[model samples]
Target: MNIKQADFVKSAVFERDYPEELEHFEFAFVGRSNVGKSSLINSITNRNKLAKTSKTPGRTQLINYFLVNKEFYFVDLPGYGFAKVPKEMKREWGQTMERYLASPRHKLVFVLLDIRRVPSGEDLDMLEWLDHYGTPFKIIFTKMDKLSNNEKFKALKAIKTKVDFHNDDVFFHSSLNNNGKDEILNYVEACLNGEVE
Candidate 1:
């Protein structure tokens, strides 16, 4: 899982705009706005400014693609559930996300969740949609650095009670401290190597 090279490839706003050649597997990250998606991506790739990080929520409004080691892509889908945007814009975002998720090249999707809060209704809806579509995804609890050890335990327990996923399918991550970075990279490596489904 050594990242020898990583570069921003493009930003796509529609399904037809996606890379023409699907030569490599794709991993996508999706979550509500301001859930640390950009931070986690930058931390994992060891690139300070690869993915744009902003103080404002809903800054990522397009599907951004990053070429990793020239072998695969790390797709950053636009964050959902940002209410500040207009109704029509939100509708368009939802449609665009649905189109990308339907792509067959997506090997794995990391569904990010904020560890400090319970899963919102939008999050639950996403889980259900994934299930209906038979999309393979794993839940990632972000912002772990903000929680104490005991609090982390409690949060994990509460989340697990609500989600029908095994412990192996969940990861607790913190971009600030590089927590869960290695494990995630290893998982991605395994997937790329045909060792994981």
Candidate 2:
């Protein structure tokens, strides 16, 4: 889809604080802290700095929503698995995410994973939780530019061994090169057109 306009709408900490008009479909992005979730969002939307990117992990503490094309939303769920935050704060973020994921308006969720490293225990747990909830999600391997061909192959193999996924369902992305941007945006367009579930 051509993104004529993409803008940050709001930051909601609870279900009641979410946008009152929920008629549009939403695609949510979730991953561990410093997993390039913000970079990927900015890339796909063709807007640099639309979603705040930071050198610090756990910077995104709220459920940030961005209205895309004035039709649907791209929801940036707070990153998980950041240990620097207080335990109580982590619990609050977890609750906020659970409520957002349970919402019916969520059309799909893109689970980002760093291609350079093995999926952490927290990542695996998130995958299992998504499965338990029967949430539809696709895996996106980020930072592909940092990996060699052999490394990429091994990483994908290791990831598949840990989580069941079809080759077609997984996408390799790089924020620096804008890799996989078109495929993601096209997939979003297809979902918008009722071409994909």
lDDT for 155 in candidate 1 is 82
| Least accurate 10 contiguous residues by lDDT in model 2 | 16-25
lDDT of 2: 0.88
Total clashes in model 2, counting residue pairs 3 or more apart in sequence or in different chains: 0
Off by over 4 Å in 1: none
Off by over 4 Å in 2: none
User: Which lDDT tens digits does candidate 2 get at residues 137-190?
Assistant: 889989999989998888888887777778787888999999888888888888
For model 2, what is the error of residue 39's alpha carbon versus the real structure, in angstroms, after optimal superposition?
A: 0.4
TM-score of each: 0.95, 0.95
Q: On residues 74-177, what C-alpha lDDT tens digit does candidate 1 reach at each position?
A: 99988888648998998888888888988766557899999987888899999899889899888888999998999988987898677777667788789999
Candidate 1 overall lDDT versus native: 0.87
Residue 58, model 2, lDDT: 84
